[model samples]
Target: MTAPIPRDIPDLPAIPGIPVLLPSHVPATAVVPPVRRPLVATYRLLVALIAAAAVSLELALGSPLRTLSHFAIQSNILLAVVLTLSARRAWTARRPLPSALTGATLLYVIVTGLTYHALLANEASPYMLPGVLTGEAAGPTGWHVITTQVLHTATPIAALLDWLLLTAPGQLHLRPAATWMLYPLTYLAFTLVRGELLVPGTPARYLYPFLDVARHGYRSILANALLIGLTSYALAILLVALDHARPNPLRHRLHHRAKTGFRLQPPVG
Candidate 1:
């Protein structure tokens, strides 16, 4: 006797020209009702806990009047989540990553590096080291500098996400929950290497609490970092789930093309 099909795999949609096969002469398209699995239950519980933790952290900022600031920061976080989720979906669906994401990431790194160099032109500080390492001499007066180290650090994360979601087929089955942990891991690595995370000698420190608190005390910094890691892992799971649930426009187009007997071919090299 053949083993029964797992329940989490949803029924295949009725796409014309596609054939379904099954073992033991059974029809693969036969309607097998979905079952409640223990894994799904655990996943849901984990999501709920993570959502609660993130909200608590945001609220713990300790001021009802700070709603605007909290909202602003959380909104950015949400946008990041949306972008990541969208990217993941596109990648999972086998769609090329929009050049906009890579471009935007690069642009941010460049702008951040330039801002660093501008702020600390002659001033010596740990922050200026990154600016020096990545930056190119701009004229005799140091009017502009290009920071390549910042790009090196940031670009790899983007490329990893792209590879995980876009290039690796069926990889999600094993690393679904762990993939999101990359956010905190990358940030932690950045902090250890830089001794200070995010922007330094910048006015934006008032807006960013975690980086602001790094100088307060070692215990406080450790606590905040742990919170960040936990919240990030949670958010990753949420993003993955959201991405899986949502469909992409590019994917739809590809499906249509595939149905019409269009074969996407690489240019002969």
Candidate 2:
């Protein structure tokens, strides 16, 4: 004979035409709260304001806030912000932090487009490096030079890596090394092609100002590249970590209060 069923275990309950087992006990689990919508909206608005300031800066300075291309990019970022906010209101009813912040990063890139332009602009200066390494100076040399410089330089690769970092499939894993290496790899290709290191008339390395800190007056280009590489990787990782950071003390207190209020609200009995 089968052993008697335990007292704690409920037997199958038979209805006229159906059989079902009912559990006697169910344990609840702690649920992780979703990132709140208002938090994302708050951040999105801040990014929007920053973008607006960039526009204002461009107008005041009577120059495109980076590249003229950046103006269109800024417009796209604004569009993304509006689209994201609208979609959240209509569908999720809460803005997602990741999506909103990705848009913010795009906005940031647009704002800094001019800075990159300034660095890469072509001019007839004795200081700027020539041909393969420097690309073109950012002065009045027109789009032909600017476009040529961009094609020759590592900016495209760097931008592609930035795009990848922003839109990686799942949870945002910060790959700082990958991001940092793109520029160096591209520049290295250009440098090798020009034989800038071995050639007698190696121009100044200021074509990549960021790389100059390690250049040591054109003596140790690779060493400088490595240094810049390390610094770039470090900063990228730090920024990504900081981006994913949860609430700090003050924010934690506010969040705690909010969660407490949510929990204390009466549920329909």
Candidate 3:
């Protein structure tokens, strides 16, 4: 308190104990925004239209209630609805649908195609009019043939392409794959119950040959159901494995550019 402070202080030597503070440096990262995909939208929309048209043709040509009951028709209906919404989302750059729904839709449609070809194509379907397959009756001509192909072949291929080409990989999981079996199992129950309710000799009383309770009885039908269920579960497992193994097609280009030290630009709609 008694000593007076000097008016001017001499330049002091750097103190070893003092610490200097400088501005922190941060590395810049490129942020990519969601991009609208017109091509994907258009492709999905076309596929949806194809599925819808096939379902509509079936409804128009056959009994609406009976046609609607078929697994193939129901699966196609789901595909159509889901794809239509997916197309809108793609166009608007919205978040895609949950993996569970999209994966189930794909699996169901694929199963429909496989079932048609493996079990119903060469053989007579219960849904088909009597004598249609034997050339004894005037069989379905131009539009009917187109409808069948669209439902069983074209639509399935298109859906698979959408999954493989457009969507990101590794979204599917084993748990959902296991859960996917539930709908098919429920359908089995429904088919059995419906067969029981129908009168004897009712046309298409039991829809498919494998599930023909009158001919095969409950014992054989259950056995057939078990075999088919196991096969379907195996297919589901294969799909999950394939999904995880597949390369990331959607972001490869962006990744490549980033590695090459090029400025990454967002994709245009």
Candidate 4:
């Protein structure tokens, strides 16, 4: 007395195969894009956590306003924000941020690391911020050293790694390099103008020694700034070249799957 099965549905084999009642219209490739590599997910998660920890220490130790006043700390916070967002996109299978924006973030962190190591880390320098990048104190200084490593070393390296290993290749272009240089230049200009605005009591906020007009005359600072800008442009060129090299993680994963005889099931739809 039961009604007949629908004509649109394919009858299941009597050998007890997958249930015909369930829909299997989706393609296996749609469910598992190769760009969602586990290695990348792990890297982004660690980078987000490390960058977050580095910036959090700044807020923990003192006034949040004062902590963010430092360019290095601020740059670290920016990287943290981007990494968090990028990670979320990556994990959720959404398109990643545009290469230019991602490249700028990477360039900023690299500059922060390079400036600290080249100009301030090894020896006594007027630009060195107290309780940062030092290892002398027993309890508190340990945190500074750890935080410094996270901000300067870990973030920069992890960012570069994500670009090289996780993200797809050939997205960056030559013109973006010039555009990337602008962010640092604008920051330098803001630092100088703010220095002029500050009252003559608190420490002059030059951000970096090379930007300090009084210590190093405008001429010398100009040369330094120009050099840094040129370096940034060159680094951008290198990044573009790397992208052109086609270090695509997704392709690699797909190739591996193919070689391993792992084919996606054809969709029914």
Give each model's clash number.
2, 5, 0, 0
Candidate whose lDDT is highest: 3
Per-residue lDDT of model 4, residues 110-194, tens digit only? 8888777776664555555434422122223646767877787788888887777777677788887788877787877887787
Pairs in clash, predicted candidate 3:
none
User: For this target, which candidate reaches the highest TM-score against the unseen true structure?
Assistant: 3
Give TM per candidate.
0.31, 0.35, 0.78, 0.73
What is residue 96's positional error in candidate 2, in angstroms? 2.3
Residue lDDT tens for model 1, 1-269: 99998879978779989787655654432222222223323432333344334334444533433322322223223334434544444333333334334333323333333333433333453223332221222322121121132122332344334333333222122253554345445654544445344466643333323334544555776675677556545544544454445444233323333233223331100
Over 4 Å off in model 1, which ranges? 1-176, 179-183, 189-193, 196-209, 212-214, 248-269
Clashes of 4: 0
Candidate 2: deviation at residue 235, Å? 1.2
- Model 1 RMSD in Å is 19.5
Across residues 98-206, which tens digit of lDDT does each residue of candidate 2 receive?
4334433433343234334433333533234332222333342433344333332223333324334322223234653254346445644554444444444344323
Candidate 3 stretches with Cα past 4 Å from truth are 1-32, 122-142, 253-269
The candidate, 1 or 2, that scores higher on lDDT is 2
What digit string (tens of lDDT, one per residue) describes model 3 on residues 119-196? 666555443332222222334576677887788889999999999899878888999888999999999999899989
User: Which ten-residue region of model 4 has the weakest summed lDDT?
Assistant: 260-269
